[model samples]
Target: CSSTRKVPSTEGKVAFNFIQINDVYEIAPLEGGKTGGMARVAYISKKLKSENPNSFLVMAGDFLSPSVYNSLKVEGQRVRGKQMVEAMNAAGTDIAIFGNHEFDIAENELQQRINEASFTWVSSNAFHKKGNSQQAFAKTDRPVSEPLPPYFFRDIKSVDGMQVRVGFFGIVLPFNKANYVIYTDPLETAERLYNTIKDSCDLVVAITHQSMEDDIRLAERLPNLALIMGGHEHDMRKQLVGNVWILKAHANARTVFITNVVYDRGSKKIEVMPKLLEVSEKIPSDSLTQVVVDKWNRISSENFASIGFDASAIVLEKGEPLDGRESEVRSRSTNLTRLVVKAMEWAAPEADLAIVNSGSIRVDDILTAPVTQYDFLRTLPFGGGLVEVEMKGALLRRILTSGEENRGIGGFLQYSEKISGNRDKGWDINGLPIQDSVSYRVVLTDFLLTGGEANLNYLTETNPLIT
Candidate 1:
């Protein structure tokens, strides 16, 4: 017999794929149904998983609250994240991490959503708090299959018989700490987790909700990481710090990241190929997911109709591409802001002027299609109506000036038609000369009459137009 030995058939590489989405809140298509529906997202996931059996779907976090749907109530209980959990379950999300917005709702509600989810969720640094904790909430109808483990481990054996192991952990950035939970340093927590799971796994993956800068710091501290996935930044980002790789996607499901991992058993090398996919009309919708989405759309419309606004009714078409994104609304005068203030002015036509905080307007994108009543609710979700209050021109000037000076604040002032002048010019009330003692009927939200959210202080209301 020949002395030459036959090479082992199992010396090939194993491939693992990951589908990542972060900061997605809207389950339905945004922008007049042009893009970004959870149905399409589900379709993409199913296609990817079909292509590669070793694929995993993930959301780095922030899907629970902050939508008009989240404000709905069923029998006096908040539907805070009931819809979100259902949609994500249909979307095939295998795992997720907590983003800062996850804390925007009450802790009990947060617990309720977490308890309802079917996927595995982990937050390495988050800890249950003492006193008035989330334990008071009722258990979800379908409890999670397992408690959220700080780290998740998975082993893969390729068709050719090559073996690979991936260990995953999730970390969240600093958040509002609203009597819910405390957090440990992400790097420290990561180090502890790595120590416990390192020897058993071939590679480490970090699914983080921290800033890219913090992720870089984490990379420097823990050099053994193979991949890092991030959220909280609203745009796509990718960077390689040393040998560690970091990847992120755009907010609102407008963009996603798909990473393919190849591990070579012979050379002990790992190759990562990443693709940035746009969530657009090209992606087809899964029938089951589309059905769920349609149901939610009907529910959302009915809920808003109960509040006396026909959510499906088209109000305005495109005059121009209106900027409604949070950054623009919170920071500057945008076309969307101008249009919304115009509506406020129209709503209170009898008043001399109308004023609102920029923060009160919330849909975060440029509208290039039909505007509906649901879009209005997305802009102003807190349910405050217009109130006409009489105040001295001096107090009006003070409120406007206060709002102007405090630019970049959510409560920053945005005025209705014909109201001009700035804090620097002493703000001409109604674009007219101000008389210190003269009374003017100013239309604004009742929230402002109680407190100048932008620091208006109300300055005392003498005459009231209660209608």
Candidate 2:
């Protein structure tokens, strides 16, 4: 009997592929009646998975926040959080991370959504609060007061006979003591996890909601990290540092990320290819996911259909920059910036000058009516209130200097019509040769007044901006 020896396919090598999508804040249909809804993401995700059986899908945090339906109720009083979980489940997400806004809901509610999630929920820096003696808002999985795990791992089989192991870790910005119960630092936390699991897994991916600098630093330090998918800054691109590939998708589900990596056994090296997928008309919406999204849309409309006027635009579309320092509404500057400035002026009259952080101006489009209170709320939905800070010329200069140095997209300080800086060329803002040491009273949001993330050289003077 001649026995034919077959070549053993069990070489110590494997080929694998996976997809990552970030900053998909809104799963439902946007107000403008455009797509990029959960259904569309679901459609794309299903197609990708079908094409590559070993394919796994992951969301790099910011899946929920600034959403009209999500903000309507707290403590699970309304079921929007549950609905989002349902949509995520239908979309076939294998894992998801957390962004800062996930805390928009209380601890209990956040846990409920996590428990309801069909896939794994992770936030490397997210901490759970222990329940009060009374156990108010307590649930079975989480005590009223306790921190949660920062990472999760899954074993997925590849098309070939190779088994691939993937590890996912998440991290959000640390909440200030006033707001957070237990805060976890992203860098420290990531290091701890990486040290623990570096050898156990074939690949480690970090889901972060941090600034670009923060992500870059992490990639530099973590040599074993395969991918760094993040948000928070809402930058739309893929960057590589060493062997680690860093990616962040635009907010509000406007775009998603698709990353590919090939593992070669001969070289014992893995090559990464990252692509940004703009959520556009080309991709069809998944029918199964659409059913869940439609419900959220109807619910959002019912609750938030009464805040702004129906206008041509809710956000300023991409175009030319506005006049240097003039605060004309007609300027094609950011609509959200214009509105926030208007709101501050209306709310705080005493302050002669008004300014807001570019980051605070989150809404990408202008608000048109049939607009929900939810729309306006989501526009600047961070619970931060309006504040009038006392500042003189010197302080104003310091704030400006700080803003200018900031590398973040929304770090620039937007001023109102009353104040005009060299008001014509972008050069004035981009080219401040020296610090101006003049004193001027300025209006700033509570976020800036507190000197949160960005460093503003300004010192406080007197009046507090209204809440």
Candidate 3:
């Protein structure tokens, strides 16, 4: 899982290194301790810094929400990404941007997490909304609140007394659309920032939380960009558009990218080289960061114990890997989704069928055998009770159709195996076709019944079709 590459000697070049990771949710090692731990990342970061003093650890975004720890209560208040910020602080993260998921918490809680961060934050397109006004998101933890800047510049000196200035800007996709946030056009904002900072810096980099297509478009629009470190996709990707390179690492720090840049003073040219490094058992965890990670793990275990659950107890031992990956669950039914829906049906035996939104499956990793209670908790972090309801078949058809249309998103439905068919072919309950006049019993997550799912607001308990 590790690759070795040689960087041409930095004899007369101004050289620096960047350790990049994105879409990370878990601070501890994942997949039964086989890969990815913030303490291990900390170890890597320290090693990189020792090799090159100008080394910087950068995170593209999406670290705050959709985590089991975020759902737990600590000292009577929701943890709400507090553990993530603490882990990152200890991991030596130098720069970060706001991912859409960062707004999943309330504004106050987000501000608290921001205030706790020791690194710099930059965003070019996201803003804070207040009534009819919009402004830059700021850190209020200090007496004098510090507003996050649109971009930042870091000046580094090579070993031989040569200096280079690197400018960085960040932008996130406006997908979340939290009421307190206003998102501007990403391309426009990136172009504007690049033009403003180009003359002052030797090279410019972009940290983004967006789709690969959008990242390619951004690269095409700003051909002068030296590099783009991006997130929002769980898999690792590397591509070149024009002269710029876009790099993304696997989610949960399963892998990371180490980018090396060399600036030639006489030629006025910049050369970029990037390497992929797997975070596995080969890399040792940093002693200091492991202490912080262990602290949170202990807290999580205690909370689970109080609820009559042993976090480490093995729940199942299947040889086949369970697919809880975000891309797969949202687009189609997988073994993990089927297991969830089956469990729902078992909970409500009287119900003819059961359904749950793919968004409920939050773990974006391939779970191996010997799955533990902690794994299930991570999979369904925003836990909800199952609700059995009796509704007209006509209403059921509409719900299924809506879920079909919501493909490739969290709101897409994963239902029991007893139900089948698409809109064109029509739906069936068990082996029989659905009849509009028939009243069918169904089990569903409380979130969907409360009309919280996307494009299914009509499925609420107050709807006339549901009794």
Candidate 4:
């Protein structure tokens, strides 16, 4: 629905600015010399809005999930979701679309987050289960007690007194259905929303958290989409793909794109001049935003206190790159990944081998200092849970061969035992390579299990250890 519509006046031109950012897991304080925390994002957003009266702030997604604060506190309780809501409210984000990770919790949990959020939660793709048995048949259904309303539609008021109605249609990632169930065809959903709002609104903006390719395709299909802002790939990119302007930011609040657009009333066209502002080092953290982040950190520290441990320099050294050949950290796998595998062994005793993606290990340096809970969180910040799968020894070899062929540094299985061949032989399991038969038990994170960034076809064949 249009909130308000204004007619254009021939007297003067009006300028409007819009800001977009993505993937702030929580209010994290910038450590080391790196800045651009949520506080800094808040600072920049507020400053920009103050400078430009007709400015609106929007975030693409990934506000929840993978967050220690949300997982430990907010999943079932109102407080978990409310913290993000409060943070976003403080940051003054006018609209937010759901990211794939947002569906990590139950639908009810998602609804609680939506309720707590003062800003608009727009999603054109997500829909309620149609049949009575839909939830029953759902692989990841959590039994939601309440359902949320449809996506949001807001009318943007231009400075020139010209009423430009802007519609925000949000779409989360489709493949995220692995851990949790939310189904939709992003392109079709976008078209449906655009068709409904195209005539009513002067501009239709698709605020999606889908992959960059999907966003680009949607823009191509739906010419009415003025802008397609996205996340999930964790890249900072801006381009005019076909008729729509696609904008994205790097993960964890590193950059914010200030996009300016001129809507030509005569031609009824939209032109976007996008500016990607690096939030790190340049902007100061907002104090008010810091309070929220600090609160979350305190709670996170208290809940996951067991994970924290001091590195006395025996186990690993800081800044050392661990590779497959070097035993520096334990060959190939970084000291960080090795520690993660140790954690996996402790968490799951039945698993024979523990595999983790290098991408999941975001920490550039080794663990140092007294080692607070934050340190562990930063190491595996993606919040990816573990998954167990049974595969044949031959199949394992094939997986490794595929990984080798693909030049996968991370997805190649790091085994506890030499399952396929011999680790002493340069970590290559089999001279015969991967076979299709011999069954073996393999453990991996949910991210890789669902075919996240890595191409692991073996995951689809095996049964999941945990849902």
| Predicted structure with the largest lDDT when compared to the true one | 3
Cα lDDT of model 3 by residue, 1-467, tens digit: 11122233366677788999998899999877889999999999999888776788999999998799887889988999999899999989999999888988899899889899998899799999999999999988779978999998887765456677789999999877688999999999999999999998889999999989999999999998999999987778899898899999998999999999888877878899999999998999999899999999999999989889899998887678999988799899999999999889889999999989988888987788888889899999876688899999999999999999988777899998988998999999887899998999999999899786778888898899997
Model 4 lDDT, residue 400, Cα = 53
lDDT of 4 by residue, 1-467 (tens): 33653333343333467788887664664444364577888888888777765577888887766554654643435344566777888788887777766766676676556666766566666654544423321113246543332454555555565656666778876755544354667888778877876787677777888766777788789866778878765557677877778888766666788888667666776777888887776677778887887787666555555345332213433444433121122224455566677787778788766666555654433345344455565556557588777866555554554554433323444444334444234233333444356455677777776655446644563434222
Candidate 1 per-residue lDDT over residues 1-467, each given as its tens digit: 00111122234777778899988778887787677778888898989788776788899987885677777876678878678788899888888888867877887788888887878787788766757453222234555434467887877766655567788899987654656677888889988998888897888899999877899998888877888999876668898888788898877788788998887777877788889998888888988888878888888777777878798787777566778876577667788888777887788878887878875665656676577777877777656688887777777777777887767656677776567777676656445777767887778877677663645554445323221
Q: How does each model score on TM-score? A: 0.77, 0.76, 0.89, 0.76
lDDT of each: 0.76, 0.62, 0.89, 0.62
Q: Model 3 residue 101 lDDT?
A: 86
Summarize candidate 2's per-residue lDDT along 354-435 as a digit string, tens digits.
7777665445543444454445555564556776654444445556555656534455667775544532322222234223
Candidate 3, clashing residue pairs? none
Q: Which runs in model 4 stand beyond 4 Å of their true positions?
A: 1-12, 31-33, 74-82, 130-152, 158-160, 178-182, 306-353, 357-373, 381-390, 401-427, 430-467
Error (Å) of candidate 3 at residue 44 is 1.1
At residue 298, candidate 1 shows an lDDT of 85
- Candidate 1, residue 212: Cα displacement in angstroms equals 2.5
